[model samples]
Target: MTRSVRRTRRILQVTGVSAAALLALSACSSSDSDSSASASASGKLSGDVTVFAAASLKESFTTLGKEFEKQHPGTKVTFSFGGSDSLAASITGGAPADVFASASPKTMKIVTDAKDNATEPATFVRNQLEIATLPGNPDKVASLKDLTNSDLKVVLCDRTVPCGAAAQKALDASKLKLTPVSYEEDVKSALNKVVLKEADAAVVYKTDVKAAGEKVEGVEFPESADAVNDYPITLLKESKNPETAKAFMALVQSAEGQKVLNESGFLNP
Candidate 1:
């Protein structure tokens, strides 16, 4: 071959190899850019997630909220804990909340029926009723039947509340009737009545008694099994921060969240 032809061929070969290298580099750069964009979109989470939860879940949910905030920096978890039915009413009435965790399915229905929930609620735990008595059992309250004594200053949650409804169910299940001295709006208030020594005993959740620590003594009865309440949680339809809300819900249903709840005396759903 001629020297000029050989030199031209050599240049053409180098040019082709360089073109191939450039194409490969460009493809890699494009792939990396797409991946980085995806990671940025899905991995970055930040905002305030307001949770409306039942009064009975205050302890466990608070711990989970703190854990959620810790896991995602630049995020805040604020909770409104109250009666489940009341909270449901607030949600349906256009309350700005990211999540709702109710103490019972019946109360959860209030929100679901109103189409205020973004997704169907899932039961996360179950709670049983327990008698909260004065420290050291001054009244010697032992069983559900013992609360029937007319002399006893017994406080109960209002029938509209989950705890109150559960208590009534247990009372009915045992075929016994007892009038309460007073009815409170929520489980916490009912339990507080006993803690403050205003009532000799209160029919509240086992979790409430556990949360009360040494302030009150918990008495469990067989009838509680018949009226165990199921706790359900869901995302609200009007949440402005849906992503953060969902992440918090995922944390609640995660193993780590369940551990906190189980430690707080909640039964697995």
Candidate 2:
């Protein structure tokens, strides 16, 4: 073969190789860009968000969870709703969670004190005590003093829970003490005692009574003014998705969030 012809053939071969390399590089860049765009557009917040809330907030918070899921689309919210103290204990014990919403500042302090919180918690709501009785309030219990009636059976929250602690404070403020047949672990349990007709009355949060919705009659006692509980919310330090957690909390503080809480009878904190 002629030298010029051989040189032309070599040039063609090099040109083909260069074209192939450029095409491969372009394809890889396009694929990477497409993947990143998909991830961002969907915000594909893919992970579990664990929430620890007070028992009294169970119903309302569950509703809020549904709304949150509807808004986030792909995120999952797992809730551990129970006594505020119990929830706090779990969070402090290294349980995995993204958020902590407590019924009492004291319980929230437990998490903050242990340095389990990622940020300063904000008080989102407040609740006051109420006298919850059977649907008809058959005992005709009217005032805090009425609870002293020997014929009336009353249930109270255990001292460890927020509602119980508030009950004690209300009683102390009234300078009245009466023995309760049962000390429940949480407000719902105390409310249950009344719901089941096992007790004549129970000292529970006003929100709880409202949540009960005619299952029990809520009577506002003057003494309850002295014992108010502040609800606090915070993001956890060990959260796997801090950004999404923060966003969820922001939603809770938003107007929509406040609306849900207020509808549940929680006072703005």
Candidate 3:
């Protein structure tokens, strides 16, 4: 073979090898970019996030949970809703939970004081007390004083719960001494009593009355202004899915989440 021919072949060989290397590198780069894009698009949250939330949050939080699942495919959110104090007790007792959302800062303090929270609790919403009465206000209840009627069988949340505490604060503020027919464990139970016609009226959260819809009539008493409850939410330290839990917390504080809460009659924090 001629020297020039040999030189040309050598150059062609080198070029071919270089072209193959370049193509391989390009393919790898493309693959990596695709993988990253897919991951970003799919969102990083997965697994289940168990949330311990207040009873009043059942309706709003459930809605947010569904939305969170929709935004993060393959992720599930399970909620345990009850009195803030009771939920706090459960979380502090080493219950397995990804997040804790309380209807009052007082209850949230239990988790924070126990060092069970991964982060400082953030207040997401506020709620006030309302008297939930039978539909059409058949009892002719108009104010807090009306609930004190001897003939009325009024129910209230247990003093340990956020709703009951708020109700007590409102009553204290009004300087009214009234005995409730029963003190239920949570706001929902207190509201349920009125809805089921087991009680003439129930002092519950305004959100609870709203959730009850036509089943109960909400009577807003001015005294409730003094006992507004601030709802706080935090990621738990023992979360099995911390990333997903934090993402869920962010979703709850997001504008979209606030919209859901507002529609459910919760006041902005």
* lDDT for predicted candidate 2 compared with the true structure: 0.88
Consecutive 10-residue window with the lowest summed lDDT within model 3: 113-122
Off-target runs (Cα >4 Å) in candidate 2 are 1-8, 11-15, 34-38, 41-44
Q: Looking at candidate 2, what is the lDDT of residue 132?
A: 95
- lDDT of residue 194 for candidate 3: 87
The Cα error of candidate 2 at residue 168, in Å, is: 0.7
How close is every model to the real structure, measured as TM-score? Answer: 0.86, 0.92, 0.85
After superposition, the stretches of candidate 1 with alpha carbons farther than 4 Å from their true spots are 1-39
lDDT for 129 (candidate 1): 90
Query: What is the alpha-carbon lDDT for the whole of candidate 3?
Result: 0.91
- Top candidate when judged by lDDT against the true structure: 1
lDDT measured at residue 149 in model 3 versus the true structure, 0 to 100: 87
Local distance difference test values of all predictions, in order: 0.93, 0.88, 0.91
**Residue 5 of model 3, lDDT score:** 100
Residue-by-residue lDDT tens digits, candidate 3, 1-269: 89999999999999999999999999999999999999979757789999999999999999999999999998999999998999898888888998999989998998899864557889999998888889999888999999888999999899999898999999998899889889999999999998889999999988889998899998998999999999999888888889899999888898999999999999999
Q: lDDT tens string, model 1, 246-265? A: 99999999999999999888
User: Highest TM-score: which candidate?
Assistant: 2
